[model samples]
Target: MTTFPQHSRNFLFTVLALVLPVLLGAATILAKTLTVSPTGKIRSVKEAVRLAQPYDTIWVNAGIYHENEITIDKPLAIIGRQQAVLDARFKKGIFSVMAENVLIAGLTLQNVEESFTKNYAAVRVRGGGHVTVRNNTILNSYYGVYLEQTDSCTVSHNLIRGNAKQESTSGNAIHLWRTDHINIVSNKVSGHRDGIYLETSSNSTITGNISQNNLRYGLHFMFSDNNSYQRNQFMRNGSGIAVMYSRNIIMTDNLFEENWGAAAYGILLKDITDGYIERNIFRQNTTGIYAEGSSRLLLKNNEFRNNGWAVRLLGSSEDLTFEQNNFIGNTFEISTSTNYSSHNTFRANYWSSYTGYDLDKDGTGDVPHKPVKLFSYLLEDIPTSVVLLRSLFIDLLELMEKVAPVLTPENVLDNEPSTRLNVWKS
Candidate 1:
């Protein structure tokens, strides 16, 4: 062979050195996937986990694995193929992931035993970043998924249901405690104590969830701040949703429907501040939005339809504004203990009960529309007085109150009521 130049030999050696590690790294990334099946070499998932390198995939086939508890301490992707079952033997959680960047996907975890203590979940992320628990089916479990003290995790595309009857014994379906920046999206939860419970968690986004038919509030958040829930549905729960002692919350494009009970409401805003409730539909609720000691809320473009008391402002609430909303077919549009002071302002809403005329050819009415009738306040004190709602005497009393307001709040006025209906295409 002809002798090569010094620079050419140096360049070849450099290229070989750079390309060697790349080939090894590619082989590591494309590492062997361990098959966990009855007939496979690795029969148990726990043994596969012990033998697997970090970032390797453990493909579990369709079979039942009696795993009372599983701890994923390494960054492994444990994916189930075709509904592989992880029966927890009526014990505690099925999987407790304690590693960073772990993924558990497409599994069926079921039959967790009920416990008075130790909230048992199907899957729990204790402390990790970039942990994703997705596309799993959890049935008859105590707690569906729990994220405690975890950060930047995702819990998405999971179907969770529990037949929990007692509140003192059952736990939440998806419970987040002290977890921050968690993205809980596109999950369906039902028949649990609370569908989703957030306590002292912050900077989280819960979007596109359908929570219904739970024993308690469909979604409850307490002492959680800077969180946003959008495009979610909360229907037919014990007390629909309770947001307590939270600040800087945004609730948009949500459906709160058919939450009818003695204490049920579409949403209970208690002691919250600096929040925005926009473009939401509150229909067929006992009370659409009950405000208690809440302040500085911007409620806009929302529709309250056929509710008992559309908005009940408690005596301690202040500085709440209702604007650009449609309040239609509500039994009591606004009810307050004492309307002597204008703690809340109402402006630019379309009320079907408004009898004002637009004489100036403008879209808005010339006179302000008062939503609170005398009957509204009457039903507040005596809820059983609705039997005489359609009688002529009740009509006469409402007409007289509309002509000259005495008992209703004079300050809670929609200054520019729309003469036409504010029909939204939501």
Candidate 2:
């Protein structure tokens, strides 16, 4: 309804001359502080916010504020002093931001009722830029922090926990829709449908976050491009992470472990292209990486340990390179739908099952290494053959398959296989 002039639109940080003695937390550092306390001139947080001007910092003291859908329609900094709690009584949302240059920090928000019709969230930002939500705790929320059409937002150092038992009735911890240039870092999320979800959101960075115990994927990205996921841990989630229909993705130094189920995978890449997945750890998952309809993948220096089917390449994969990696103690090293294809390359990787002799004193083995086993191919055709995994007859068949390459692909061999495991550097 109201818009500033062209010259004043970007002057959000211009200091005003409005003088007020605010509380001590961020008021000591803010331009102006509007104190909200039980015994102060402003008794309620809503009253303080209603009378506060732009660029003013509203400090809510350490107390419980029972508010339903407190909306911020102007540029302001609402910082809670000593982590004040805002209880929505399981009836509505706690905070909603519709303005740019808003900063919400140091608060405990709780209790947003689940509604099939309304996507009730603890904190919802609707079309804003430079919104910073940091160092807060959200509990029992339908959606902890929902950003829609926002840009340049930073959500950092927050803890979000939801009680979501079913996927159809639950929401993500942090959901971004059509947002850009956002940074999500150092957050802990648990017990949600999806811990962090991105849909059509691009140029974002997600780092140093721990997402676990979620009912769905720990981090789900669909149709999002140019995103970076680094230093994150997805443990015991329903299926770890999923990147679908995206390009130019960089995933590095993340840990995907203990995501065990018939349909679970450490990372699922479907229709993804031009991605770099390096230096990550995938352990104890049903499948370390399940790739289908993907191309131009660079997987280097990663570790896949003690998993079932370390990597599964479906029928439509091509142009993938696994270099200088370590595959240790996996039940099945590589499994493919069709005959193992030469479209992917595996060079200088260490496989624990490779019993070759480096007689030349060279670190690389003289003979080529084949990762696909006969039992894996047999299991693919008839899954009931898994019952004979440890049988001596199956061992003989696998040894015979390894002695000769009749059933496997002719060219899917690592010529320079490493005799030693590739060590990780930090």
Candidate 3:
């Protein structure tokens, strides 16, 4: 046995302590790249994932790989070259990710059959953080990209399409449950039950997504709070967008169009409090907005055009402020429930139906605008009376009621109505 002096041993230990971290960092920086190809030694992605270390790169080449339920338990980047397709073969899910900082990009995952007892997704991040699933195409899956108990994850720039006939058999295109700080950006989701469904999720941002032609809602939020939804398009869905049981939300710069059904609206706000619905365009819907049991919501700079009812305020909703909105060519500019004695305030909104003049040359009309028509108030109890719309007797009844101030909710008047349409650049 060779023994060194005490000073020499201490110097060697100090040198090793300095060199070891650099060597380990170099090893981490030089993470190995595993290849998955048709004729390669590592042909399967599951094999690649099994043989990969943390922060390794798995490059899948172009081919149709028949694989399912591929679990990734380590942080890895799975990148596809050319058009790599992972066919689930109508079996289980494609990728079940359980690791943080995982990236799955530029791949096609398809054919995850519907299951009654399970939710199979094309890419599912369970109990993970900072996972990203981007630039992929998900087709015919039960769920496109599912985040369960995930935080700080992103599902962006993906095209998720499903052939959903009924709501019972179909799932959402992008579903988030109990997630926080999620970024769902620039994705196009259609033909699913709901395009994007958030339940019990909070502090998330959903922007620049086009959610159209879904079976149920374009975007559905249930019990989700403190989220931001901006610059999205919700068009031609069965029920449009439904934000329910949530608080402190911000919805701005969205386009809601052509959601025509007897029960459909541009948005249905139920039990929501302390939110902002600003700079949105609601066009050609059955109703632009239907608020029930919502409070303290600021509806500002929104345009409601050519709708059956531009705004339907139920009696249960209170303290909603509608300001600087443009209500143009709607059959009924506003509707309220029978007992509509709420503290809803409407100010500075431009109503095309308003005939009041501004004699003082100010932008605001001198006469206040009463948006709720008598026929609209009557149709709240007798919905079948909508067939009598545009009739002479109904017009006369509305004019008389406007002069006398009868059944329409008096509190839902715009004292400072805008003389011209408000142009918002949001």
Candidate 4:
């Protein structure tokens, strides 16, 4: 070990303290602001970028500028005064950022080009870190804000609306590829192929977003891990959200509602492990949650209501626990295949259809509530038989099977079913 003398260390600290402020002041002095307006000398944003230096601010005044394929290669803040518009004219991408510490805010970008072999974005940040795209409106873009191979970036408070009609041509609203530690917050996305799509990203936060009326999943992520999604609304899309091939996910306090289609689900979890899902509302979807090859997941304090099937638990899932959730007004509470082994547990949940009494005043039913109905299991094999759902003969058969516990999976039951609604607390 080498040690400095006391006077030597003190002198070194004194030198650093004297020089650091001058360097910081020099950086601040070098960062200049350039203004652009329709009537000004610098009328075009591309020309403003060409005139500006690194760490400069390009302030675009409120006007319409027809520009496309504007490449930004230096660190800069491209801010708009009011809601300045960038019209791409359906030619190419609006802003392509390849620099660090870049900020693009308070701008409306529209008419990004649609390409068969490329993804044209309103604001594309590629291979950069500490970038932010905030308070912007993206209209009719192929991809609203695309982040690729970036870290520590944020996309927040942006409204991205696309006029997408089909999945073959439309791109995602917010697309992330090979990024990490990104924050996607408070954005509204609609009419895109996917509202928010992530691929091979990790350690990110997605919260307070509205994703609806899209052609595909509202939020879709694959091979991303250690991510958290909270307080987001996913409604009336082709499907709600798809989380696949990930591990250690935290999904809580989200609303999944009215995503109605034959193949739609509130959430599709496939090949995932070690996840925590709590306090989410899954309502009026074709299926609330469909889990396949998922394991070691804790689903607690969730509400499933008025869906065709609340949960479709496949045979490959194991070690899952559904605790303190509410299942109400669903056509089928749970549906499972015949080959499904009872490797999951359901405990202390409330069921609206539960008729058992709590004789000892324990607030739990004396008899167990079987959530997986025989008819639902039959529908797994014969989906066409759902037309006979409300008939008297089907009702009698369901009644008989409930009393006998036949054909339904024996272990799939809420042993301590709550007698009342809203019994669980956060």
TM-score of predicted structure 1: 0.91
Task: Provide the TM-score for each candidate, comma-separated.
Answer: 0.91, 0.91, 0.94, 0.97
Task: Give one digit per residue, the lDDT tens place, for model 4 in 148-250.
Answer: 9999999999999999998999999999999999999999999999999999999999999999999999999999999999999999999778889999999
The most accurate candidate by lDDT is 3
Judge candidate 1 at residue 367 and give its lDDT.
Answer: 86
Best-to-worst order by TM-score is 4, 3, 2, 1
Residue lDDT tens for model 3, 1-426: 999999999999999999999998997788999999998999999999999999999999999999999999999999988789999988989999999999999999999979888999999889979999999999988899999998999999999999999999999999999999999999999999999999999999999999999999999999999999999999999988898999999999999999989788899999999999999999999999999999999999999999999999899999999999999999999999988788988989999999999998789999999888899889999989978978999999988997898677777889999999898776
How well does candidate 4 match the true structure in TM-score terms?
A: 0.97
- Residue 422, candidate 2: alpha-carbon lDDT: 85
lDDT of 2 by residue, 395-423 (tens): 99888887776786666678899999888
As a TM-score, model 2 comes out at 0.91
Per-candidate alpha-carbon RMSD to the true structure: 5.4, 5.7, 4.7, 1.6
Clashing residue pairs, backbone N/CA/C < 3 A, model 1: none
TM-score of 3: 0.94
lDDT of 1 by residue, 1-426 (tens): 898899999999999999999997996778778999977888888888889988899999999988867888988899999969999878877888888989989999998878886877898888877899899999989899999888899999999988888888788889999989999999999999999999999999999999999999999999999999999999999989999999999999999999999999899999999999999999999999999989999999899999988999887888999988999999888888663464788888888888878988778999898887888778777879889887899999988987777787777788999877665655
Highest-scoring model, TM-score: 4
Clashing pairs in 3: none
Query: In model 1, where is the ten-residue run with the lowest total lDDT?
Result: 336-345
